[model samples]
Target: MAIIGILGTPYNTVERSPFWWNKVSYTRQSFIDVFQELGHTVIVLPVDKTENIKNYLPLVDKIVLTGGADVSPYLYGEEPHAQLGTTDPIRDRFELAAIKAALEANKPILGVCRGLQLLNVYFGGTLYQDLSLTSSQIKH
Candidate 1:
């Protein structure tokens, strides 16, 4: 079975939670179930545990960057827009590290939702931090 490294999303601890805000990185159970059902093992690449990201590169056949908070616009050399809402810089750093390691190792990577945005910026692409910042007629 192929091992899929899923980059975990970090979040603020909810009310009554014990974990510190932005200290936990996790993938949803549904993601784990779906991958396991398909006979692939899922490993969570935690945002707060990026120190060992390079070591993780050799263990998985593919990397899965899941949906999460908006990526930091600073990563793309742009200042954050007032409407940028929330962003997890910790998660950004973690995923970028993972992406670098994955490319150097020749491992395939998949991006979902916000993950796709970050991947684009990582590869010399830019994003309109907010749709309002763009001149496109379409609005979100």
Candidate 2:
């Protein structure tokens, strides 16, 4: 059986668990469920220590990038835009490094939501806004 490594989204909250366990890292159960439905063991991939990503890659046959906060604009060389939503820089660091390591180690990766954008940006592509300033319905 192959092990599936799913990247987790880290966030801080005051609810549930002990007070000291506020910072949480997780992915939607439904997202991980699909792999389990296919008989693969699902495991949350750790990106807390990006430098050690290569070491972890060998343990998983495939990598899954789950959805979460917006991709930090700074990552793509652009200043923050008002339209951009909340982002986690710490999560970005690990995921980016994880992607690089996955590719170098010949492991396959699947991206969801912001994860897809990361894959695009990593290959020198930029995010596109179909609406123009004048055409955009939302106020600046």
TM-score top scorer: 1
lDDT of 2 by residue, 63-94 (tens): 99887777887877888777767788888889
Q: Name every residue pair that clashes in candidate 1.
A: none
Clashes of 2: 0
Worst 10 residues of 2 by lDDT: 127-136
> Per-model C-alpha lDDT, please?
0.85, 0.80
lDDT of 2 at 77: 86
TM-score of 1: 0.86
Query: Candidate 1: where are CA atoms >4 Å away?
Result: 18-22, 135-140
Pairs of residues at least 3 apart in sequence or in different chains that clash in candidate 2: none
Root-mean-square deviation of candidate 1 = 2.3
Best by lDDT: 1
